[model samples]
Each structure stands twice: as structure tokens, then as C-alpha cells.
Target: MIEIKNLSHSFYVGKKGKEREIPVLNGISLEISQGEIASIFGKSGSGKSTLLNLISGFMKPGSGRILINGEDVTSFSEKQWAAFRLQNFGFIFQNFQLIPSLSTFDNVALPLVLEGVHASQRKLRVQEILQRVGLLEQANHFPNELSGGQQQRVSIARALILNPQIILADEPTGSLDSETEKEILNLIRELNRQQGITFFIITHDEEVAEISDKRFYLHDGALVNGGVSIEV
Candidate 1:
């Protein structure tokens, strides 16, 4: 389980010489189980991304503790977070974040390369993930050559390649058309059901929220209506 307790964060923004602390998340607490699919809905600047960053260990919270499976990770160092992320978390974003210069296969294999996996092993893993995402035929194609849905598929493949326990998605369907968005949602659901991977998705769309087992709304720096039931 992932447990967040009284988490609060703020940013200093203003003139270079004078800045004030602008609160983002204020006394937020939540929990996600091992294989649950949860969605947090928020408007722009609602601290949705900030929450994800803190949970993923990309940023430290100003207060409170983040516990994953009974381990406190709030105070982890950068090096520790790096190793931890590689072992436990995967990330997906609206922009896809694929390398334009590299082929789909190479893009998905980048994480394994960082882990010092051998070339042969990386190839096998990348191939398996690509096939799982239904993108094996496009492995040699560059990002620019694929459709938007296909590109997102590559991004999903890359995320799953590491076999992480949790997948953090920020507005995952923000750039897709309705049909493509449905396809992506179905893919996410299938993966979660089959692989038992947990998903913590942040979005503004009701469609995305409908697919979640638990739903949350972030308002005024606090999470409201968390774990509420929504008609799927």
C-alpha cells in the first residue's frame, strides 16, 4: 500500500530578490492499494502534478511522510530516489516524452540501458513490452512517423518495460481524440487487471475518472471527495 500522511508543499515564486511561499498541497493524505486504479481530478494549477511528483519521489514534500508498503520514503536522498524509482515506479505524461531521434525500440530500452542491462537482454525486454502494447511492428519507426495513439502506445510500452509496481500518469489522454482516448483507457484497464499493477492517474476528464476504482478531487490545495464512487 501507498500511504500519504499530512503532506504539504509550497513553492517560492516572485521577483528574483523577493519571493513568497505559495502553498500547493496542504495537509493532504491518501492511500492506494497494491492493484487499485485511482484517479485524481483537478483543474489547472490545482496541484495535481505536484502531488504526483511528491509521490513518485521526484520532489520532496515540505512536511509529512510518504510510506510505500510500510517504508517511509519522504526523506530519501536524490540517489536513493533514483534507485527507488527505477525499481518501483513508472511514469506516463500527456506529452509522451519519447525521443524524436530514436526509434520506438530504442526509446523503450533507454531505462534498461541506464540500469546497465546487457544489449541482448534489453532487446528481449523491449520486444516483449512493445508486443504487449501492440506496437512491435512499429519498433523501428521514429516518433514522428507514428500516429498520436501509436506514439502514446510507445510511451506506455516504455513505462511497462521496467515492470514497475505503480504507474503515474498526468493527463494521459489530454492530447488524444475521443476514440483514441477510449483505446488508451481500455489498454490501461487491461494491463492493470492482468498484471496487477497499480495506477495513480491525474486528469480533468470525467471519462478517465469513470474507469477508476477510486476517485478524488483536488480543490484549494486539498483533496476533497477522495475515494468516492463514480459511475463508470
Candidate 2:
């Protein structure tokens, strides 16, 4: 339930008065249906991550419109974006993004805490998600105490704790071993199949793109595969 139209973005480098524009995304347009698993494949500096950031409201596009569930979020203020993101989006990062000091349970419970949920309810929600991600036993452990795969599961649990409509994953399996990556990928597929949560993944790995219902190749700040391709 996301639509992007004529999306473009650029960054300026060099000194203030004599800056040069570096285009990152150019006229990008795409639609992701509800419950769809979509992946964007691109090498470094191809604007795949930029597209995700724009859609996630982390930054505004230079010239474009972004619609999520029929509402134009292109001009949302920081406050509005924060509220909307908490209500609508989940995020998983390559680095897992877990706090070393917080245990798995607390890490996964942070979102609910931010939303002001009561302790009892937060406990139940966090436990359920942690179990779903197969990390219940590791709940008491800190991020540094767990393996890489376990830490990523903690990240996934944190993302799922709020029951977000869409999960935006960036290089989700990047730091894991091959076997762990396969396990994580299968978990993602199962989550999509069973929960109907939409997934928008940005990855360079073909194996990661293989799990998506639709895959697109992005190059030189433009989508090179017509913005939609089933083939890997």
C-alpha cells in the first residue's frame, strides 16, 4: 500500500558557495501492494537505500510524492512522521541495531514502551514476538552475549512487536553466515505468508531477492528493471 511518483533526490558536496549536486534517485516510481514481498537490488550508491529512506520519512525527496495507504506523506513534519512511523512501520537493519546494554526482551519492548503501553501488556507482546522469532530463550541475554543470527532475530522481534503494517529491511542478512541467512530468509517468508505483513527489502544479495514476489534492479539512481521484475 505504497506509491511513489516521480521521486528524485540529490545531495550537495564541496564548499558552501561552490557545491556540486550528486543525484541519488531520478524519477523513480513504483507501487507495492498490501501483503506483497518486494525487494530492490542494487550495488552501492544506486539509490536503493535512498528510496527506502524517502518512503520511511527519514528524509524528503527533492521532487516527488510519496503516498502510503492513500495519504500523501511527502510533506509530513518530523512530529507527524514520528507518529505515523510508530503506527505504520517497522525497521530491520543490517547491523541489528540492538543496544548492547539492553537485554533482548527490553530491546524488543522499547517500541511498546515508547507508545506508552502498560508493563503487563508490553510483557505479553514482547514475549509473543520473541517466541515467534525463536528468541524466547535468549530474552534475558544482552546483544553481545548472543550470536549474530540471534541478534538479528532480536532485531526482527523488535520490529514485529508493534505489529507494523510494513517492515522495511536493509541488508537484513548481510552480516550472517550463509546458513543463518537462509534461516532468516525463511523466517521472513513465513512471517509474510502467515501474518500478511508487507515487506520492502533493500539488498544486494540475489538470494535475498529470490524470496520476494517481485524484484527490481536499480542502477545509477534509476530503476533499470522497469520498476518491477519477477526474475532474479
Candidate 3:
């Protein structure tokens, strides 16, 4: 569903009024297919999130091409990029980044709200996704009213409520207890098949790689060729 070629990104640091180049992504390239669950694994400062941000068009690479569903997104204008992301991508973060003041239902409905979806239709979609995430009962609660795991479920509900073509999660299970982590992972697996949304996650968990169709191990901004292990 996505293709990246010759991607490289670097940040310039200003020290004593002098500029220094700090490279994060160095000539990396990779592809992900539709309906496949894949991962990018690496240590801290490995450029994994940089690659994800680049793909999301939130950040651009100094040099590279990013193709989503065969369209060149590298040069899309800001408005175009925003619309594209709303229609094509769902994002989940390590911290369950829900709006504390909004009810779970409202948080889940924010994406559609911004898109001008009517209240009735938005209710149906948000409720359905909340149910899928096992958070139907918690929908009326604010972010602080739920447990860590429950909050993450609401975040997942918010992300999936858009029914986007791709889901990008970064350290999804990092903050959960092992048992809760397993619960969240299983939800992701089930959602993958039932929704047919492409999954591209950056994780540090071994079991996550074991469950993926393909896995990429990144180091020092370069993709380790054939680095991601295939599902056995």
C-alpha cells in the first residue's frame, strides 16, 4: 500500500551559532502491501519514528519519494496532505493521547466531526468502533475516568473510527501490563482481518514480530535488508 525510495532525513543543530547535521534516516527504502501487518523494530534513536512521520507526511525527508497507493505524496501541499491523512491514515501512539475533556464517544468522533459528518451518522460509526474495541460502556466516560488499558482502547477506537486504509501505531503496548498488552495485541490482530486495514507498527515487543506478516529491523537509519522476519 506504500512505497518509499531513497529516503533520508537529517536535522541541523545550532550550537554556538554554528550548524551541524545530525542524520536520522539515511538512504532507507521499503514497501508495505495492502492488508499486511508489518513492523519496524529498533533501538532508541534508530529513526523508526522519523520514517513513520515521513510516511504520514507529517515530516518530509531531505531526499526521498513516498508513494501511498501509487500517488506521490512528497510534494503535496499542506491542505492536500491534511485531507489525505484524514482519509487514508489512522494513528495510535504509545501514550493514549485522548482529549481529557472529551467523552470517549466525542473523542472517537473528532475526526469525523472535523470532516463535517452529521451527528447521527457520526454516532453510528463511533459507537460501532467503540464496541469493536470493547469500550462501548466506557464511551460516556472522560479520559481520566478510565484505566490505562481502557484509555488506550478508546484511542484505538478513535483511530479506527475513521475507517482509514492504513493504521500506524508506535509502541502501542509499551505502557501496558503484560496481560493488558496481550489483550491489546489480540485486538489489533482481530481488527486487521476484520477491517482489512493495513497495519504498520513500530514496536519493541518480540511477540509482536512473531505475529506480523513481515518485520523490518532498522539500525542507524538504514533498513537491514530482509531484516523483518516473515511469519512462519
Per-candidate TM equals 0.95, 0.97, 0.95
Per-residue alpha-carbon lDDT of model 2 for 79-98, expressed as tens digits?
A: 99999999999999999999
Predicted model with the maximum lDDT: 2
How high is the lDDT of residue 222 in model 2? Answer: 92
Cα lDDT of candidate 1 equals 0.91
Model 2 C-alpha lDDT versus the unseen true structure: 0.93
By TM-score rank, best first, the candidates go 2, 3, 1
TM-score of 2: 0.97
Give the per-residue lDDT of model 3 (tens digit) for 106-145: 9999999999999999989998888888889988999889
Residue 216, candidate 3: alpha-carbon lDDT: 86
Q: Which ten residues in a row have the lowest lDDT in candidate 1?
A: 223-232
Put down candidate 1 lDDT per residue, 1-232, tens digits, no spaces.
7898899999999998899989999988888889999988888889998999999888999999999889999999999999998999888889999999999999999999999999999999999999899999999999999999999999999899889999999999999999999999999999999999999999999899889988888987898764343434
User: Which clashing pairs does model 3 show?
Assistant: 215-228
- The C-alpha lDDT values of all candidates are 0.91, 0.93, 0.87
Off by over 4 Å in 3: 15-17, 226-232
